[model samples]
Target: MDNNFLPISREDMQKRGWDQLDFLFVSGDAYVDHPSFGPAVICRLLEKYGYKVGIIAQPDWRSTEDFKKLGKPRLGVLVSAGNMDSMLNKFTAAKKYRSKDNYSPGGKPGRRPDRATIVYCNRIRELWKNIPLIIGGVEASLRRFAHYDYWSDEVRRSILIDSRADLLIYGMGERQIKEIAAQLAAGLDVRHIRDVQGTCYCADNLDHLWDYVQVPSYEEVIASKEAFAEAFKLQYLEQDPIRGKTVVQRHGDVFVVQNPPVMPLTTAEMDEIYDLPYQRTYHPVYEKEGGVPAIQEVKFSIVSHRGCFGGCSFCAIVSHQGRIIQSRSHESILREAKLLTRLPDFKGYIHDVGGPTANFRTPACRFQTERGACKGRHCLGSNPCSNLTVDHTDYLSLLRALRSLPGVKKVFIRSGLRYDYLLAAKDDEFLREICEHHVSGQLKVAPEHVSSKVTRLMGKSGKEVYVKFMEAYRRVNQQLGKEQYLVPYFMSSHPGAGLKEAVELAEFLRDIHYHPEQVQDFIPTPGSLSTAMYYSGINPLTGEKVYVAKDQHEKKLQRALMQYRDPKNYDLVYEALVKANRQDLIGYGPKCLIKPRLEQDRPEVSRKQRRLPVSRRRSAKRQRANKR
Candidate 1:
């Protein structure tokens, strides 16, 4: 496989080479700083190792022309299985839109460019049938088996089969990708690269293989998309040969093999990766086509850490970044901050410096060597773990240090800081420092739901905990004479939040005068335990029955409670209050709640003539009584 198939920038080709190359990287995402997507970073890393590399980005490689334009390569890497579901959803959505009798009302579902990976992989196969086409990233990696497709609601086979990729690399790809590039650079052939950790390849013959293999029953997975997604989730476990857990898969005549797991990149590797000379300005390529970026101008979100220790059921950080909590040293974060400040468009404040559960520092517990096991590294299943080392003294120190640096006037911890964790700050002085310095007007925290049952399901901090913390926070702010506000992030229609619970939550919000600034509807992002629960109504972790409010009307009512003060939404809130069986909230909702319209006074004869429904008639009667 020659690397020249990729059409490189003419300037880059003239400058970097005597041009025959060892590798070509292709991705469906715009190349950005940090290695969120595998092929993008892998291409940069190959260049670092002195190999000629070309990138075919956001390509629609559906035809032989797309492949020829990409150029033939010694090795080909297809890195998309994009950030969302497989591509079939687009066709499904388009078909739905075209067939709609009415112009399909307001919300159109989003779809992934699924055929990107399929087209690219199939085209590469056409160009050189046996060339080593390594497919990885979320799309290919998770699809490396016969699994459920949520969009299509059907069982689908490995992308390696569909896209015809030579191998599938799953999980964190830095170490595995680096090793792959190094091997190719050293002229090692692809066949001999067997059992490489974090690598999956199709192969022949599993009959002769030893060791216990857990091949999930096709029927069990096909029972439902949720069932299949659950089985698939469990199947993608970390393997450390040194730790003695490796999975091997046999695919027809070819075998998909995995090496002992590679420890995810440490903080230093993350720093080096982030330090890549990326043209950080938002490339309005989508905007050029008159489309907006899914996220507009999040120029401030630089990752200071690569992973998280929190295993909240509602989160995918643990699965995607792993629970390792690898963090860049203070110097690296400061350097990035300084660079951002120095940018010609220099914004004074750095938005945030953290990853999942931002305030949670690495090595959550000091007890790392109990019987040579890290007690803190694995907190996914354990909630409010006793060993949680959430002290913010170090984080506070980091924030203060950044604030004190040259060219930096302020540094806000705008990223999520776990309220429960902050409440547990070992040092009150640090808490005070956070209140005084870290927060700019408002501090955000995810007290996901007000209900304790929902909190437990979400693996989130409870409402009472947040209440207690809020009281303490108010006192601290008052004592310091600072008018800082606590911005609570709430989620509606999560698992177990039935109408009754939703009503209870609405009333709770009313009582506290705590109408949240933002109410997030449960989105059910892929690969998270919550997504499984949302899809199946059962917790994948506990296998316990869970209640998820999937009804659109119920979700709207709960969200409307968060905006009870808006005059335009008053009637909606009142109706929601009635439905939630919390009519008490109509008069005594949030202190700022708007008043609803009252029915005009009418005589008995006129009321009889109106012939309203019993429910509406009762509501009108209640309105008349309230006026009296």
Candidate 2:
């Protein structure tokens, strides 16, 4: 066993000559001591600050026995549902159980319970009633408010209230956890520690809370859709760290008070966090079960920055990481890259070097550091902000230095690149360089949808911008004599996307001679503007009523249209075309999407095909070849 890893067993704690640990972490994920894993980062950061910490990963939640393995800690017990929300990890967009758990040993399923954080906390309370409980990470952070639950198809109370934890930390949690540990060490009562930023606590009265804006009560939001939309809008706008005010909401007799977000980490602070000594792999105990599968994707990857200003409505990046970008210095990243090269199994390639958005190496503009992100406006959405700073000089320099590393063969930018932001740059050097160096034959980008109305609702650039980006990509690849293809990711059944909009996307795919292998159906997870729209049928930002496809059949039809060429999707695609009154697209014309099914013998070619012009038949033949 590596002594560098934090103690996971009582024997390991004994080996460290520790009688009691300062903190014990409970997590839903298998213990992988990598920076990408939230539990590992928090535990390692605590260790670096002179606190003895231990972790219990994926404990059996059915009984209190597993929770007793690490015993009670001296200071507090930090809990998280791993790197992802447990509900999202356990189920798919269709609410079906996933076959495998990437964060578990042997890629097995059912290693953790449904609501892992609540379950783990309950088990811990069974053994030790008054242990200081802190819940952070993706599950608690996003569910720290009264929000909609897609799986239950109803509104649920805040996770902090349901889990009965003392403190709820949101965002990346480095700053919040450090402050929290210090206060606990200084002997502050957990219940009375209410002033920490980036945390949520339940209060009995409003006397202690100041400068706070109250949203709708939980009763009102559940009873009225309009009230729910209004509450979400207020919560969404005040997420800024600099100019944000404290937000309070009522839940029955108690009030949940959330302090303003923690200040963005400086370059030095970012450097210090990533510079901690991480084992960069799963614990050796899991080697027999083939190790944790999630580590494979990030073993050689590096996180260049955090947060995103491209406010896509369906995404939770702005809600969790906040919109302000906190980036590491080039020297810090290069140091990590050197560490990666020395790992025993490192093949020459560096998998990725990015975070939320790969190219966002700085704040959105000059004023963001001082004024914070505009209250209700996006830096790059339907319309780009005039003051948006679109520079890639620093990111390009970092990539160049990484490429010149001693043992690094190739460094890929696998993270999502905001093409609209890239296109907004004054120079094309970044695009040209990415085409020549970073791309690995296919560069995937998310256009989401092409319809103007749907794109507007999604807070994405319109079809024109995607087309402009595609053309520029083609031009750059041509100039560089590269054959790299651009793979655009599209989503279906999003709010405001009716069958008409779905067919428009299908037509665009048909015109471009592309057949998508997969299509993303929108899933309304918590803490996103799109989820509010999905629940209330109203866009929270705007008071307009939006069309939502709630029926499973409608969602299936919308998804099928994106892959209309598949034989299995023929029935759904045909039905969607008929319902949209687009039967003209069902004939033998050169521009038609699919062949019309015969009434008598559905498999036979119709007379429409025989009577077609030879040129049109050749065109149809070419189309068939392309689909193949």
Candidate 3:
């Protein structure tokens, strides 16, 4: 579990003849093998490029002593902090946001720095001093700002400055990583590596750096919430290593930084990366000794694709993967599946496939190195253009091929694949295949919010889109003769949502008789566009007008919406309605608190039993049933 106790040491590097190493990948969390994606994939890709890479997973990164164990490398280090789990304050906000909704004792689940990455970076800075530490991944990528910190409950600076890393590469690093390696291999110093796309590093003089991408400053965003909200389709500002500056931008904010991908993987190169021999275990060696469950116990999932054209604000995929959809070839997927089947505990099903917003196999439109086609940063944001290519043909073909492979029974799309994109498909064959084979009895979908205004602010489609998707889902299920239910995911207490909107949502739920078993209160993870809105009550990148549900009372009303079906919540709902002065919600309304209120009123009536009319008292049973 600890890097110090790791069997492999510097001596092992010497024994393996790995001198003048090409890459040193410092992983921030526990190591996972079988799924074989993320930083691990990048590591394998570097090996193919003839680089001797060392993977240090889950280092106790608190001190410099542990960092010195790993010998120095000729090339700069590759750092990835993984993705955000949850924001502490966002979780706290959820408690008040949905006071009626029962939550676990501790609070909403949130995440902090992975012990390995945090400790390793601190130590790496102490030991290596000036050596380059190129940081990437969701955790490191998003926290490049001085934003609200829920745990300590305050605003903090960028992780790059905190960790003291050299270069910060946001988004997918396949293309960027290759370019960084090639430049270093060709004897180009890290100081002159400004041309690389999807990368951010510090420089002494800001003007000299490739014209600083024109993104709104944090101060501007904090001042005008609306402008910040409307700025970028996705906003994640990383810290520049050289100048100690930050690379911040709005999703659709401005056209400042447009550095093209240095080496966007072609279909063939993607094939090569996925085809690498992956053990596919979180701890590959541990599985053999029964330290963990075998594949038969838990199915391994892999991502055949990344990115999405849909620019829904609630989603961070477009910001992370960009609007361009990149994919792994069918051949590569099949090979990996075959390898899974050959494993000792191989099951007849491929657990899941896809990433970011899965099913988005290619760009929404023809992507060019010259002028970009995706003006909105999300395909679903504004309408798709005439040139926009919405094709499920290749993706469907990949799905069918994987199912045809031996030892593959089911291939689930566990990741959130945009329903809008799936709905855009002209043919029903893919949907049919999915309904018949891919789905379990319960299917998961994220409709986020139902209110149009809230949906707009959250950067998601309104209730209508979700309704249409539901209809489509039913049609498919009926055609397949399968009894499946779509489990819809909804969010409460977002930046712009208030009590009125929450009550409206409750009414909407009442009308549809849709009572979700689980409701998520919004958690603002680092590097997300919405985080800015939640923190500053404004959009940082663009100076647009925006609303934020930051008040504690406002959050409570939103939480009340989720408990409409429970009678125990009557008093709670009644209080919320009374406080809001919304008498309309008092009786048989979505915000009705009559059940508990009536029960409470019963005790007082019991004390005055003799005052009740005999006839009225006899009919009390009938009255209760009718009211209920």
Order the candidates by lDDT, highest first: 2, 3, 1
Model 1, range 1-628, lDDT digits (tens) per residue?
A: 1122223544456555545546666665543333333554666666666667776555555466644553566654545644443443243321232221110112123322445677677767777887778877766655556644545545666666778776677765767877877776577777666556777665565554465344444555556755554564454443222242455444444554554445656677877777755545423333354332432234555566765665677676654555555677788777777777777766677776776667766665555212212322344322566766666666767887888888887776766876676677665676687788778888887777777788777877677788888898898899999998887777777888876776667667767777666667765545566766777777765577888776666777767767666556666677776776655554423442444345322345254635667688778768878999
Misplaced by over 4 Å in model 1 are 1-11, 33-40, 61-64, 81-112, 141-148, 186-192, 207-215, 224-233, 236-244, 247-261, 282-301, 366-382, 516-518, 564-628
Candidate 3 on 344-454: residue-level lDDT in tens?
776677778876676778777664323443343345642444565678788788888888887788888877767766777787777787788788987788777777878
* Model 2, TM vs. native: 0.96
**Stronger candidate by lDDT (1 vs 2):** 2
**Cα lDDT listed for each candidate:** 0.61, 0.92, 0.61
Error of model 3, residue 303, in angstroms: 1.5
Which candidate achieves the best lDDT against the true structure? 2
TM-score of each: 0.80, 0.96, 0.81
Worst ten-residue run, lDDT, model 1?
A: 98-107
What ranges in model 2 sit over 4 Å off? Answer: 1-3, 604-628
Q: How many backbone clashes does candidate 2 have?
A: 0
User: Which wins on TM-score, candidate 1 or candidate 2?
Assistant: 2
By TM-score, the candidates rank as 2, 3, 1
How well is each residue in 1-628 modelled by candidate 2, as lDDT tens digits? Answer: 1447889999999998998999999999999999999999999899999999999999989899988887779999999999889999999888999999999999998999988999999888889899999999999999988999999999999999999999999999999999999999999999989888899999999997658889998999999999999999998899999999899899999999899999999999999999998988999899999999999999999999999999999999888999999999999999999999898898889989999999999999999999999999999989999999989999999999999999899999998899999999887899999999999899999999999999999999998998999899999999999998989999998999999999999999998888999889999999999999999999988899999999999999999999999989888999999999999999878778887875323333356875777689668768978999
